[model samples]
Target: MTTETMQADDYFYEFFDAVSNSTDISYVQKGDVLLCEKTEVNQFGARVLPTFYCINFILSLIGNGLVLCIIYKYEKLSTVTNIFLLNLVISDLLFAFSLPFWAVYHHSEWIFGSALCKLVGSLYSIGFNSSVLFLTLMTFDRYLAVVHAITATRSRKTMYAFASSAVIWFISILASVKDMVLFDVQPGNQSMMLCEMTGYHHNIMKKWQLIGHYQQFLLFFTVPLAMVLYCYIRISIRIMSTRMREKCRAVKLIFIIVLIFCVCWTPYNVVILLQAIEMSNGDQKQCSDTLDYALYMSRNFAYLYCCISPVFYTFLGKKFQTHFLKLLAKRIPCLNITIVTPTQSSKTTSFRTPNTVTEH
Candidate 1:
């Protein structure tokens, strides 16, 4: 064979071997010969993603932590909506806890070993699924409170809220089982270790990854998004018909919550869908390169949702804002701001804070 043919053959052999060991290989065609190319996605991720992850970690930690403390100190979890809020905060915190590890992993190798690889992978899976589920539940809770208030009164109890949260947690754990089983500390380019799926035949590994993509796209994104849209539509119709401007105002924050969720997650899931399609169709170098950049950027943007959620979910609430300011003033006596606690009247007693005045 000629020198060029021999070089192409060598490239094929190297590609085969790399595929057998790792799924991070891409192919580019050079002068009618397909050559395996190691993508610089990791290097790019190292430069960009670690900064984003670190910022998200700090903001999510402090934001969700303050939400938790405020809920525990000032708010009563006697209402169903409050219970769901508590669960959502917990989910965000759980997800936030995994970011520091991922930030470090992107910056360097997976030095935490196999056990932590599985644990952190599973934590991310569970946190993401649970966070989406809890948001959907909260949206539904608002729908009932606004559209079917009387009919939902008996069903929307704190006990039922706890039961629903338990079920969501169970499903989230089930979703993470696959990650726990497949993720490990695997060798990557230049002998670096990565926390990724391993321990299966190359073909089988690709199938499993594809399955995960579809599972997340369908179960976490498509289904929940549909439910949220339906609930909000019904809520809007009910409120408009009743001419309750206050009711519309009450749900404005909830609408913002759902909007933020959609804006943050939709791009990431769309990228995953495109990636699944690209994987099934074999390698397209340009497409693969584009996807790698899109995935990292969009995923980091989605991570910011956990941090922004606290502001819309709790801080904007009238009572929560008052309580938080009071706490702040107390912490810094130099501010000397006086916060008056509103008296509990019969009208206000019917609702839990002005945010969800429609809810009993």
Candidate 2:
């Protein structure tokens, strides 16, 4: 209450603020007075990441849209595997819808506001979760069709596929709700509004981020990966014993599918897991700077999966390629396209047959 006491308190506060601002590490202040101190951001991301996202967005949109059109235009391509591929396409396309926003976020600030941030972030999560789940489901469907061909044929229904898709979407949306709740627009050190998680406190933010990274590792990377590996391994073993002449190509496609998924996502997941461990274990200062660099590069590569899935679809499905070319011919009028209705032999017993197409 005295004038000298008030002056001393003011001086102490100013000195503390000066020390906090002059320090290298981020500081946590008790009061709401925000300090804008210069901290290093991953400059490589700003320089290179936007281009990757932009290319992913364009290619995924076109490729997925083309697949959807082909599926709708042709009635013979609605097998359970194709249906799952449809879901995968939809998931990737929806996720691709968020890439433009993310490209902007990486290149500059998050000017899209909190609600849009939540929407876009949530969509990204849903897309990724659903994409993984769909791939898992597709592998299982193949397993059932190959190993338990009679049961799969007798029990298959369009309604069953639709119901399963509904459940997948429900689970994916539930997973993404946390992202919507956690993400918001917050001020960064450089006076930029960033759309990211900023907890009510620094400790809470770190805890939540670590939890998120682990959650992604388990759900997206580990569990589905295990399922895919199991199903594909069994499918490979079973196909080897069968009399199908296309066994080599089938096995090759299976390997490519699993390989692409793992190669694109595993490194990114590992980087995040290492970052999470470093944060939780209190080795932030000792962590390698290359971790930050790897995070940027791996993430860009992982995001490419959205565009890459459609490439797999186009390459592996001869019928799909035919339909896709036909669709293109219809649109462009100058290209000559021949239509081929693929006939499957009875021995083809896999879910990829004329019967499977007809049933759907």
Per-residue error (Å), model 1, residue 34 = 7.6
Q: 1-360, model 2: which lDDT tens digit per residue?
A: 000000023454567777877653333343443232212334567778789989999888877777677667874435566667778888998889999998898787789999998889899999988887776777677677767878888766777778888988998898787798888877764577888865454556667777789988898789888987897788788877877677787777778778888999899999989888887786625324577777778887788875667556444655555666777788888777777655665324323621121111
Q: Write the per-residue lDDT of candidate 1 for residues 1-360, one digit (tens) a residue.
A: 000110134465476676786653334322345433434766788888889988988898888788778888878889886898888888888888888899898888888999999999998889888988887887788777767879898888888899999999999999888899999877766788888877754556778888999988999999999998898778776766774547666467557656777889999999999888876876545324677778888988778875556545665556776788878988898998888665665335334422243421
Q: How much lDDT does each candidate structure score? A: 0.75, 0.71
Give the TM-score (vs. native) of candidate 2: 0.82
With candidate 1 superimposed using the best TM-score fit, by how many Å does residue 227's alpha carbon deviate from the native? 1.1
Candidate 1, pairs of clashing residues? none
Worst 10 residues of 2 by lDDT: 1-10
